[model samples]
Target: MIKFAYTILYVQDVQRSLEFYETVFGFTRKFITPDNSYGELITGDTTLSFAAHDLAKSNLKDGFMKSSNDNKPFAMEIAFSTDNVEALYEQAIKAGAIAEKPAEYKPHGQTVAYVRDLDGFLVEICTPME
Candidate 1:
């Protein structure tokens, strides 16, 4: 049987990324490696993890494209569900996130907004559909 356990994002600073997610998304830290090279958060069903860039390089011989400090965000995005999209969107922006799109009603009866995290990762904050 196959089941999704977690998703790891390669970041320059594992602790920093972990803190940002904790502050912005209210996710609690599950644990961080003793070396501080990797960390994970308790994000509902699937775990959200972050690994240092050096750790990623050691894991992937071919290397991977990471979100740049000055370049635009990557095409992919991580979506988070919330009951109050507007409030959460505002909170995210205030927490050093860049607003990509303001909250708006969708045809599917969902309120959705977009923002870019400190690492230039696209994040979609939305309310669940009926």
Candidate 2:
């Protein structure tokens, strides 16, 4: 059976990205490479991972767009479901995530907010859909 396992974000600093997620989302470290080129977090069934930009480049022959705080975030986002969207959103901002939008209730009955991670990747803080 096919199963979704993990999502790895290419980042300039794998260690720094791992620490940001740990500090803001409270996910524990699973493992990191000896060279600090890659790391994973214990984020439930689907692990959240990070890989150093150089490592990522080596894996992909054509190269890829690198995330940056100076650029607008990409269209996609990684979402974290929580009971307290507001609190988590606040904590993310305090941990160096740029606020893209404040927490607000959606017409569909979910509370959602948006932020950009240190690497400029979009992140969604939201309540579970009932």
Candidate 3:
């Protein structure tokens, strides 16, 4: 049975991303590599593995690979669901995250907002419809 799964994101700077995640999501370090290429981050019941972009490219070479700066574009993102959307949104901004969309109650039924990480990965922070 699957107990849990972690999302691994590739970032340019480990410390910058680490500080952003830790501050915004309240994540605690579970483990960090000596070279800071990969690690586990825990917040509540979730564990996120953050890998440096260059390292991830090499790791994925066994499969079909593309340059991190390919012309076609290489990108990914993660959504952070939270209860106190407004407060977290404010905190995220204070933590140096650039807001892509202001928080609002969308017609689709959620209080949603968007922010781009240091590397331009979209992070949707939201609360489900009540």
Candidate 4:
């Protein structure tokens, strides 16, 4: 059976992206290439990887859409599960995340909020459904 191992985000700076995830979400930096072109975070079962924009360009012939400093964020998002949405949302903002929405409860029994990361990638902070 095929299993999901990781997801890579093409970023302008690998180290910076890794650090942002570390500071904002408490994820630990797992490894980074010596040239700083690739990195990953220790995010439990599925690894969150990052690749430098230049490296990504070299790897792809047709190129891929990516979130950028000047452009609007991509449609998709990465969601993180949390228990204390309010506190963690505030903490994420204080850590330099741009708040897109404050936490709110859904009929499904989940408290969810949205934020943009340093590179303008959408991130969702939400509580688990009971």
Cα lDDT for residue 94, model 4?
89
Global lDDT of each candidate: 0.90, 0.96, 0.74, 0.88
lDDT of 1 by residue, 13-95 (tens): 88888988999889999999999899999998899999898999999989999886477878788999999999999998998
Specify the highest-lDDT model's number.
2
lDDT of 2 by residue, 1-130 (tens): 9999999999989999999999999999999999999999999999999999999999999999998889988878999999999999999999999999999999999999999999999999999999
**lDDT computed for candidate 1:** 0.90
Report the C-alpha lDDT of model 3 over 61-80, residue by residue, as the tens digit.
56433323223234555778
Candidate 2 to truth, TM: 0.98
Which of 2 and 4 is the better model by TM-score?
A: 2
* Clash count, predicted structure 2: 0
Considering TM-score, where higher is better, how would the candidates rank from best to worst?
2, 1, 4, 3
Model 2 steric clash pairs = none
Q: How accurate is candidate 3 locally (lDDT)?
A: 0.74
Give stretches of model 4 more than 4 Å off. Answer: none
TM-scores vs. true structure, each candidate: 0.94, 0.98, 0.78, 0.93
lDDT agreement of model 2 with the native: 0.96
